[model samples]
Target: MEDVISLSVGEPDFHTPWHIREAGIESLEKGRTRYTPNRGFIQLRQEVSSFLSRHYGVEYEPESQVLITVGGSEAIDLCVRSLITPGDEVLIPEPSFVCYVPIAQMAGGVPVTIETGPENGFKLTAKELEAHITERTKLLIMPYPNNPTGAVMEREELLKIARVVEKHNLLVLSDEIYAALTYTQEGHICFSSLPGMMERTIVVNGFSKAHSMTGWRLGYAAGPREIISLMVKLHQFAIMSAPTTSQYAAIEALKNGDDDMAYMRGQYDMRRRLIVDGLNEIGLKCFEPKGAFYVFPSVKSTGLTSDEFCERLIYSKQVAVVPGSAFGPCGEGFVRISYCYSVKHITEALSRIRAFLEEL
Candidate 1:
């Protein structure tokens, strides 16, 4: 096990950039440790507003539309708690992150999974969205640049889904935590920025993925003023404020972390290409992912279930990748390999996988 090559986690291998870390340290040195606003510092919120506006063309009023949470996880929990009523159905696209469905359930809302297939690059299609909508449907969990599958929704695709959402008057929780890691030529498309979507969409994002600041535990949710107001109230009563030091550090991230983002995304892009090609050559059919740091390859060719394949691979080759069934039932025939490690690390893992496949 000491020689195991683990590719199961979806965090960057890079350290937080010096400037961002320095900002956190500076806050400590200057004694800026007291709890700030329940919605977080006004300056950090303003920076988030400006960053989104400049990069994605989505303008939010920092004072009214933004509410900072502990992380994207809390933002999701807060939005679901604030908006959902018992028995309300939340449309969650399958083969996505694991949290959305359970969080919806904890809010006493019904979780309805809409299975997304690799045929459409694993994206949640307009047809799929429309098919899932019913009289009880209240919200859609749009986790793009998606986890496990690394699926990203294109602009035209978003427009198509947005039309369905508008028709049903469904609210959307667009989790774009991996928005900055997209490897597409046109870059990541912000879901809420779609026409007629912003007003009905809650955009949840944070510094963890983009800034490699996972331990800092900071994220923000932005949406219509009325909804955000309720979310802020929930935050005030439940968790008081986001960490004061992290909020100050996030200001630095939103303001000056562009170059760091490019550098990390570039590295992930290389590893993405390497793993996709390696898996395909080794007989697993991999759909080319346009975003995020994962490559999901079908294990059906090996005549093994997703769990069986992962277990055998780990035990035999000392290489670990997640069984995609962990994401959703629709993911049962696939395995998710994260490309967040170095090129050398990924190369060794690929070689081991190839050898394992040959031995089969």
Candidate 2:
């Protein structure tokens, strides 16, 4: 009862591995402190290109198709800014990561949110995609291996969406930061991997999730040469270059970090099953998540709104889970519980949640 547990944040609990840290220190020791090319260090870009092809079967030329950014967050902002014009509509599925809609709005684009519920496994269907398109639709922010809900679009599902995307001639900002965390029957699928979809898809991925390097602040985007170049131009003005130390470390990560990723994925998979089973046993309905480290469980049966449940839990039980409504309107009636903590912590947190619900 004395221990406090928090399940609110989606970040790896693991420390950045030793070799990657050493790579950063080595860069500083060698005085490799100067500004890298605006696009990023050439070596890092090459590594990213290779990593993508090897892991996801997506190909891109290092010199023309990659631009390293501060994080996946910045990569997303740049993609939206470069493509969206005033009054252009960008399709977003909820409950998704929070930044997409705001970034689109900041770029003078209209954000049209489509609600995908638990009944559908939180996936945005091809029918939903087609129904939302119009002449003004310019971009679709594809946040799969999704954040709050941890939903993933399988290859067949992505192909269905690709058909709609092709018919509408719209651009796709595909965020695959959590691709390595998929836990469902099938692994994650990149929309860009589909035939003809690469030309229209801007892929954003980072080492934060996979390499446990969030503090390193490194990520990259890849796409057609023309789009990548425009993003680089904007990146040059906005962020002279990504952090030099992080770039050096990222090189080591792409080259030697695959084992580290596999280890973390296995741990997450165990924690995921524990939390999902525990929640269901306590009468909270949780949709099994196929990717990412968070679980979205409905709190409606407790007769408390998502916000009310989260507030009460934090104050009374010393447990913190984010209200799903904070992500978007469609997220109402659910709360997001992150599995990024220790297994013991997850066990204790769920027990407290169960006690709280029983009291209701």
Candidate 3:
């Protein structure tokens, strides 16, 4: 624990940009602390709508199609519960974020895992989706610019997926939490922006990753007004509104935070290259991640399970990283390292990881 270098946290090391924080402070100073409507402040919702339309060409009616929640996790839960029924199957691609399966199960839906791997860039294929389809299958959770693995789905690939989704009449829970952090030249493509997909997808995005506002606890889901109405009803009973200050902060973030996000993304891109190269040189066989701030490298060469590798690394070298298996079983031979820390932090962690590998 002493002098340990951690590359485990999937959060930006950057502070919320001054202007955005100032807005929150200004809101409080102005005595704007009363409870907002259950669906959140209408202006924030309108800003979210404008942000989505301008950035990704996905348009939603701010009044009825958007529901703000405590965070992306809450938005995701609302989506699952709003659509899933007992005995229905929810298709999830793994190794991904840890929440989807549990959320679906809690909604009385069965979680069906579809394993994706490096051979296909960790993307869910149309063939795979078709194969998994059954009468009981009701929803597909599309987590792109994915967590843990840092894989991104391109528009062409998404088009293929959309075809299948339309054919099967399946609804998609498109989690775009990391959409703004992609490394591609063309940038992120909103799934709902694809033709015929807008009405079929619930888009979940938040300020936590892009604006470095995880502590703010704010997020929103936009989609068909019918589905959003259900989620809003649920949110009203469970959570009255997202944090008032956070909502105020997020308004500023959406309006003027693009520069801040881009700056942080550039830093993360630099760190991403460093860690990927470092792990490969250390013989960990890392895949170059194209999005998000994490690298998932195989630890199989060390002749250890993912859990074994992470535990041994932590105890022996005081370096902490998460075992990929914690995301899903298909992740068993890998470990996830976050590049959201500083260049110095990532460099030192890489050095220690190399030393640890040499010891083994």
Candidate 4:
């Protein structure tokens, strides 16, 4: 096909807002290019602290509970490294973002994958979580508003898991990068907001998804002071500071980017409904995604594995989507369709997928 559609990419389609770009440009022109403090620029950290507390009701002291990293990815790495020792077990719910397992492994920890399926709405249930815990379990990677599945844990659901976590004495590494993209009627609820959970949870969030600044590489982690200190020490030796221009741009994002987020979220929300509805209408079983910009639809009816389905669709129809199996084993019969494209692109892609599946 001369023209193709891709639903595999994850970043927002919108460009960084002009004012945020201008802030970065201003920083560059002013020769503010020196390395910031290892933890991060104080102003940016303060802005992040305020943003988290204001938006998520999680209070983090700017000086001690926050550390700016290269991105949410690096923040995750720091948490796993700071908390995991050799042979320690990290519990990860499957059909998740791909980085958690390898990062835990690189940190000298073993990753134990728990299969979470559509029957549970792809959520990590309290019983499932409790079964996975042992004295060896050191960390749990809570990735919701999830990446491929777009599953979000509301407050009630999180509270159930928190009770189990408290019983097991587990430390949680919560990835909230997509918190701003949740679509449920109740909206997104951070695990940190649950009672008795914030003290034991390390939260990773960023401007990438919320502010359309992925390429800028600005993200941060917030938690108790002691854990944050260890993360900062690791950050100090590994990387002295995050990007200077990105940090300046992030300050602008925190201060004046709410409108931009609302506009972008409105667009993604529209596309999210369109794609999920279209997939269901096409005979694919799509779990209504309540958060993030992806639709994880079951392709089992197509008589093909997730990888086979993706390959055939890409080759035959020139519509690219990622195989859900790439996320984890439980994702075998599904595929992740990202809504980070234009409306026209989403419509065309869904149309092509429909035609392709009908042929089967």
Candidate 5:
């Protein structure tokens, strides 16, 4: 019996780089474990501010506009909780990360899901944005370089969406956790960097995807002072602060982890191409992904639901991939395959999938 080939993980398979790890170790060695501030260490916030401004031209004040959180997850929770009131509608693009809708519901907001499809590279178009907005709509959860589909919105596309946002006066929580992993020559554009967008967009990013720092439990949100201040107060009451040693390590990651990011992104890109081509050759009809580490391939040709396909594949071939239905109802005909694993592992998984398809 062969071991299972698991590709459902959303994290980078790479370990946290050495320098960042050493920084965390040194912080602990020096007894830097005490709580810093409810907003997190001042220096780490400063680094977060600098990193965003330097790389994406989106500026936020270290003192007031940046609030560190346990992870991007908590930042999402904080944003939703701070802004949502009962009966307020939150627009969430479907086939997104699982947390957005649930968090909005838990915060007393109504979640309105807008379905995106492969016809548009799974991107949320301005038309889709316009169609979903009601007078009650208060927030738009934008998860680009999207999770299940690996979709990325370019600057021109975002400009159109921004126009809709401006027209509707909607606040956006842009989850840019996978920002550094974009494959386009133009790279990832920070949503807040667009003219007239800074005031309405809360950008949530973290060290997890880019630095392979998933265990570090560090992320930050940058936005207008008013929104950020409220988020900070909520964070202070609910969680107090993010971890101290992780903050120390994240400073090093922000300053010195570029080369490591490039290396891991390059590897993911290779596996992405491999799995995409292999899937298409096996008649799965995969779209080429432009960002993130996932390939969402249509398994409709097999005449099975996403959940059924996933179950059968894992049982018969000992390979694991997430059903797209696990993301949302619109994802029912697809399966999400992660390229975060090594080429050899991806190759083996593809081989197993091919055999499974033949058997079906």
Candidate 6:
């Protein structure tokens, strides 16, 4: 624990920018700590609307379409709870963020995993999606700029999925929480930008990953007024409001933090290449990740299960990475290594990993 080079964290290592922090501080200094509206402050919601439109060309009415919540996790929970009915089936693609299955189960919906492997760069295919649809299928969690695996979908690929969603009348919870950290050449594509997707997709985004506001716990859901209204009710009864200071901070992030996001993104891109190449050179057989801050490297050649590899590495070499199996069964032969750390930190971890592999 004392000397571990841990790469298991899934957040930005950067400090929240001073300007953003100042906004929150200024709000407190102005005595702005009262409970915001159930759907969050109107100004913040407007900023979210403007931010989404400016970046992704996805428009939503600030007053009716956006509902702020306590991080993307809460937004995701609201989407599943509000939309899912008992005995309904929710289609999820894995290895994904860990909450989808449990959230669906809590709503008395069946959680079905659509396995996505490295064969197709981990992007979900139309064939894979269509095959999983059932009469009971009601929602699909479209998590791109994905966590754990760092996969993202291009516009064409998202269009393929849009067609499937339309044919099946499936609603989608498109989690774009990692939207800004994408390494794709075309940048992040919002799922709602696809034809007919705006009506069917609930876009969940937040400030944690891109803005380094993990502690601030601010996120918002942008979608149809019908759904946002329902989610607001749940939020009102349960959460009352997101943190007031964080909401103020996020307004600043959405309004003037593009340069900050761009700077952080460039740093992440460099670290991404560093870890992916290092893992491949060490014979871990990692594929290049196109989004997020993590790399999924296959440890199959080491003749160890994902857990065994992770445990042995941590115990013997003092290097920590999450076993891919923690994400899903399809992730069994791999491990997730994060590159949110500095270059020297990553370099040391790679060296330790190389030594660990040689010992194996």
- Please report how far candidate 4 places residue 124 from its true position, in Å: 0.6
Candidate 4 ranges beyond 4 A from true positions: none
In model 2, the Cα lDDT at residue 183 comes to: 82
Cα lDDT for residue 338, candidate 5: 89
Q: Candidate 1 at residue 321, lDDT?
A: 96
lDDT of each: 0.92, 0.93, 0.93, 0.92, 0.93, 0.93
Candidate 3 matches the true fold with a TM-score of 0.99
On residues 1-360, what C-alpha lDDT tens digit does candidate 4 reach at each position?
677788998988899999999999999999999999888889999999889877778788888889999999999999999999999999999989999999999999999999999998999999999888888998988999998899988888889999999998999999999998888888878788898988999999998999999999989999999999999899989888899999999999999998898889899999988988999998999989889999999999999999899999999999999999999999999999999999899999989998998898
Q: Please, what is the TM-score per model?
A: 0.98, 0.98, 0.99, 0.98, 0.99, 0.99
Model 2 Cα displacement at 235 (Å)? Answer: 0.5
Give the distance in Å from residue 32's predicted Cα in candidate 2 to where it truly belongs.
1.6
Per-residue CA lDDT of model 1 for 1-360, tens digit only, reads 879999999888899999999999999999988989988899999999998998899999999999999999999999999999999999999999999889999999999998988888898889878887889999999999899899988898899999999999999999999999988878888888899998999999999999999999999999999999999888999999999989888999889999999999888888888889988887889999999899999999999999999999999999999999999999999999999998888999989999999999
RMSD of each: 0.9, 1.2, 0.7, 1.0, 0.9, 0.7
- The digit string of per-residue lDDT tens for model 6 on 1-360 reads 789888999878899999999999999999999998889999999999999999999999999999999999999999999998899999999998889999999999999999999998888999999998989999999999887899999999889989999998999999999999888789999999988999989999999999999999989999999999999999999999999999999989989999999999999999988888888898989889999999999999999999999999999999999999999899999999889999999999999999999988
Off by over 4 Å in 3: none
lDDT of 1 at 336: 91
Model 3 residue 133 lDDT score: 94
Q: Model 2 residue 93 lDDT? A: 94
Judged by whole-model lDDT over C-alpha atoms, candidate 2 comes out at 0.93
